[model samples]
Target chain A: MTQEKPTVVLLTADGVPEPADLAEVRDLTDVRVCTAGTLADTLPGAEILLVWDIFSGALSDAWHAADSLRWIHVAAAGVDALLFDELRESDVLVTNARGVFDGPIAEYVLACVLAHDKRLHETEAFQRAGQWRHRETIRVAGRRALVVGTGGIGRATARLLRAVGMDVRGAGRRERDDDEDFGHVVDSADLAAHLREVDHLVMVAPLTEATRGMLGAPELAALPDGAHVINVGRGELVDQDALTAELATGRLSAHLDVVVVEPLPVGDPLWTLEGAHISPHMSGDVEGWRDTLSAQFLTHLRTWLGGDEPAPAVDKGRGYVSG
Target chain B: MTQEKPTVVLLTADGVPEPADLAEVRDLTDVRVCTAGTLADTLPGAEILLVWDIFSGALSDAWHAADSLRWIHVAAAGVDALLFDELRESDVLVTNARGVFDGPIAEYVLACVLAHDKRLHETEAFQRAGQWRHRETIRVAGRRALVVGTGGIGRATARLLRAVGMDVRGAGRRERDDDEDFGHVVDSADLAAHLREVDHLVMVAPLTEATRGMLGAPELAALPDGAHVINVGRGELVDQDALTAELATGRLSAHLDVVVVEPLPVGDPLWTLEGAHISPHMSGDVEGWRDTLSAQFLTHLRTWLGGDEPAPAVDKGRGYVSG
Candidate 1:
């Protein structure tokens, strides 16, 4: 007899499964994949709780109360939302979509770097105005770049930048971790010091005790004039007020993929910074992205179910820190 | 017995050299670096003609007419300015600041690809306008890109894009006499055919008779609709009217570093293409760029005086083709 298909509960809020995904769900009669937009209902008989965007805010008490919540697979790459006090204390196992975004996000970082270095926006404006101004730009090659959070995103960015002849240095909690050594990996404490010497700084770290408000007035001020900043990590990790103020003075420039108050309120000064390149938190939204995410989730699920140590298990001590 | 330092003719309309540049130009004695700006005054007794802004249309005549001009070095990469009927017949050995721009221009192409793929502009607009509209974009990874022109710029762009997980195909004229064969290099003829299959098409070609008007209406229409177009090559190579029309419809998008009529002109409709990115021809401009160019020129000058074939020569057939 064929073994019974395992049960799975997909809590992807506002996500409508495509026909192909539905077919995967219906393949196993024993597998009942149910979605919950809000965390109101407990996952009944769910061996796997796929917390897509369903776990964005504080989770419902009933979610933790459910004994069936043995495993939580976050659809998003960053899992700080699920790493709340209650969830962190649980004995439940958690895995994230680490490899899914490494390349796309890294591409985003490079794109921002190119856009800033090349004065793309100004060029576009000049083109529209029918003006041919022979402007100048700096070459990214051979420049120093500091990537905070030397995880998948940092690793990918470092590799891409290094391939272009950039002197890439990656910063994390510590550099001696034999478990990971990417680019010219350095320690987080030394990141500010590194910024002084580097030309570009890309933040891909999580918003946690060690990193929240890490790039505040002092840090933003630390960057050399004309130094550029791109943040693909959490917005709260940077002090927006300080960033905008610094940019206003033309000391530092920035490209923000995430904002402290996304859809930044109208009339916000950030909209006016000539050097600022803003995107709506979309560094990882690539076409067919859902499929990539699902495939990654399926692969990880198989490994976890086989009792193999999960490829990207949660490091509760470090949270989710990568690009 | 020291050979008199070469008298350099700074062939630019505006003869201003930065202090730092003057310091480096010390190798030339009496440093008679005259500016041959006016059409009639092609520096007399000038052994070396440093052609800056050689793209200014009239330099071809000046270059060919300089009776004493022995070595002609162009500030810009494309020697099309030096390739007219007159100069082609002259024996003046032509050199260019070729390698100075290879990495910088390549970085510009990569930047355009990134900006388009990430939708940085739209996102920034939405963010500044306080509008939250989520959209998915194409991932450069796992996609095929055809980088035309397998010279220095082409090679640099391909390497960086490849590092981003892009399947890159490089194409150039594989001549029998040429020793450099970039692996996976295709012949130029294959480019027109390759358009239909590529996701991104980056043009770094020079403005030769074979290349001018190469990416015109028919070629632009032949490309798969969504393919992102980047041209750091000669503006004439791409039919400007065709590109503007295609970009207007948003069926195709482009980042143009060089355009046919730059300083586009006041009120030119070309400035209004929703998908077209036009800058004031600044891709090759970088902080302290002149220094790099001068440094490169000096290296090649040393090599030439030492009785060695310069590391690369200007391809008389291709005009400004590099090492």
Candidate 2:
């Protein structure tokens, strides 16, 4: 007697899980691809859901139809988009593409830190106008960095920064002494005190009730003058208005890869803020990222098929992976 | 019996030797501060000359006036300005501020590498225009780098790049196996072959008979498409016209901290090149650099005054420190 293969519904947007990527998991599971519009119709008999479009609200909109869904894998490091009341109350296991983003995001953080210190933007402007101006740049070595979060991405970022001679301090949910990269780990509650001494404040924390709006006017005010804020974490982690105000006054600078609202509206003042370097939420995306995401999900599929639990399971209540 | 102090001539431009810096050496020698216009008058009785204006041609023009000059120290890494026939032929010892520039220039080179790979310039433009554009950036880690010159600056640059996980190779006047930072060290003659395989071709070699105009059309053409040329060495090391032509066609890019004619004439096409990042010749200068330069020279002064030879003595023929 042959065992039936589980049906996996790939919910995507703008053609994610391209044909080649879908082929990786197609042999093991009966697969169906659907968009936000057709997700409800496709979710009826699927026991597994690959939420490739983590930005879409279709997962919550179509939760009633996911009667057979036992597991949900978000093709993103953060799973905030899929934590609706019904999904949170259900007994479904949720996992995210954690390790895939660690290296690329760490690289992006370093790039931003170095760029801010060197004033590359000013150099480029001078180049464009045929003007030659000499300016002294700050040294990155021996500078202080505070990485807010101690997860895989945060640890990876801390290690890269430390490798280049930065004095890195990490802030997480609780203090831990076993970390190799962070010179010191402190409770997230003590972040404000640490902010005053850091030259670079890197945000790589997951979005949760406790972390959301963590960096507001008070936190921004506590940072030392000329400190650069680099956010690769979710947008809500920082208060956009407070950041803009600080940037406008030139008291602080920021390299924001993600914002509270992405595709940040055309008129958003944060875009034109004097020291703000904005990118449209693509820090972790390296070449052929779609393939990597598919491969990550395939690894979990294989583990689940062999009667083993898929790793990096998120705590639905906390909205992140907990120890 | 009283010992007469040596007369030291300090040649400067634009107020370089600030009063505080001059005070460091004033009590040790009979010091005469002069500019390019007044250098000839001051050179007549000086036993030591501090060439603070490394870019000035005054040293060559006023060489005939030097009657007692025994030692000439240039407050710069390169000694090209004082490499005149008269100075080279005389028994005058020439030394440079070599170790002083190595660390700062290396940091600048790393900054350029990170900025170029991350396209920070483009991100800035997008930010200025209030456009939220998301683009995938190339990873610097595991990328190949060919640093030309194995001296202090080049070795420091190689170390920083390697720290960031780059595969770094060093090219010097001769092959060496003892370098810890470089994976392989090759002769400068083989640079063209290596350029084709590297992502960053960093020029940190001193200006010398063998290295001047080294990176011309043929050498630039040998580099793989999209390779960046970072020159903290000297302006003449690269052929400006050839580099400009390559940058104009968008096949190559460059971050030139030094140019053949610096304070690069306002109308040079190199300034407007599509992928050019230009800064005036101040890459090695950080905060309190003048003070540091003065201190470095003072250290050597005490050694020379005590009848000991000052270090980092340049070989007149090769124009750099010889082991």
Candidate 3:
């Protein structure tokens, strides 16, 4: 008996959008690509679902009814969305887009931090206006940085920041065995404590019930005055209202690539915060970006076809667990 | 017999407009703080001559006659002005504040690359006017960078660029034994070869007779079209006229900390280069910057006084050497 080409559904509003890359994967022709953004719409027909942009909701009802939906490939680095109580009981396989944007996201964080500290905007304006304003700039070397979340993005960011002579620290849910080598690695509980002392705070933590609103009013308060922030993490990890108020007072300056109300709404107060720079949620997306995402999907698909379990068989309880 | 307290001179027209830090250094109660508008008037009565704003031609005569002048410390990073033939032969000790700016300068290079590629100006304006624009940004990772003059400043820039996954190549006057471990290492002779292939060019070399007008018509033409330049190096290292012409046509964008004419003469056409950014030469001067310069001098002074050679001793022929 021969095995059949697995039925696959490319869910979410945007999934790589590269026809050339996906052409080879058409062996599974019943491939349904609905820009159905919500889990409710995407989970019904998917024997294997490919989710890119995740919303914080459960698709338990759809998963329960679908007899064929056994696998889920998250198109993001974090998998907090599908790790609900409903999916924990099922034998559904889960995978994530791990190494795709590590370099690009790390590059973005560095660009923003350097731009802010060196006062590039002012320097640029001076050039445009033909003025000679020689203001001193803050140096990144010998400074301290605290990166929340220790997944691929956080690790890449830490490495980049450290190479520039920044004292970099990484924090995760639990301490890693080789934590000492990556600077001051801290457990989740110590995030607030670390915030107070860091020169720059970079948030890359995934959004989960436990991690949501992690950098709230109290966390913002703990940070030292003038602490710079670069958030490439999910918007929910930081409280938008709290961040706006904090930035308004000039106590802190932030380069936020993620926001609670993305598209920033119209006339959103976040747009008015002088210290807060909204990047339309684009720190990870770069040229040749779609090609990289599609490549990750192929690797996982090939493994499943070879009768080998995916290396990152998503632990439904922990969402996309990094095993 | 006890040694005399080291004589020190503060050699700028108007800085801090006060001599507070100079008071901290030993001996030389007769501090010659020359506020000479013209270099021709710099006095002849000093044991140590510090040149901050004064020119090389004006001091060339004085340095030849001042037998007691044992050392000349350049307040700036590049010591090309102080590295004349007469001074080189006189056995006068020379030193510069090299490491003081490794981080800030490296930060500047990274900022300009991102600014041009990410379209930061348009983005900032849009965000300020409460408009959200989703313009695509060029990814900095996986690009090639050639950092000329592998001293503290160039090395620092390389480390930062490499952190973000750029293929960082360093060019020193000569190759060292350990050059292989640090990306692609080339000698200054191979600069033209490196420039042709590089996407980003960072010049951190000190001004020398050989290096002056180094990046002239031949060099600029060699660079791939649209290649970006960041010059924290001396202005003469890049031909101002050639660079201005190149920038006017919009093929090149330059971030200049030092220009051929410092404070850039009011009527100079270099001012009009739309792509050229003038920062009033502040890449090395940060707030609390005096302390850093003072501290480095004192640390070296400790070693100089203790019968050990300074770690970053000036190469009399080559100006400031890498530490």
Q: Best candidate, lDDT-wise?
A: 2
Tens-digit lDDT track of model 3 for B36-102: 4433344444556656553444466555446577666665677776667877787777877767777
Model 2 ranges off by over 4 Å? A15-19, A176-178, B17-19, B176-178
The alpha-carbon RMSD values of the candidates against the true structure, listed in the order shown, are 3.6, 1.6, 3.9
lDDT of 2 by residue, B115-144 (tens): 888777877877776777778887788889
| DockQ list for all candidates | 0.61, 0.74, 0.54
What is the lDDT, from 0 to 100, of the residue A108 in candidate 3? 81
Q: Sort all candidates by DockQ, best to worst.
A: 2, 1, 3
> What are the clashing pairs of model 2?
none
Name the top DockQ candidate: 2
Residue A26 of model 3 has an lDDT of 79
lDDT of 3 by residue, A162-241 (tens): 77777888878876647643655788765777687887889998777777888889889999998988899888888878
Which tens-of-lDDT digit does each residue in A17-100 have in candidate 1?
532344554454244444444344546656666665523653445465355666777777788767766667777778888777
lDDT of each: 0.72, 0.86, 0.73
Query: Clashes in model 3: which pairs?
Result: A94-A314
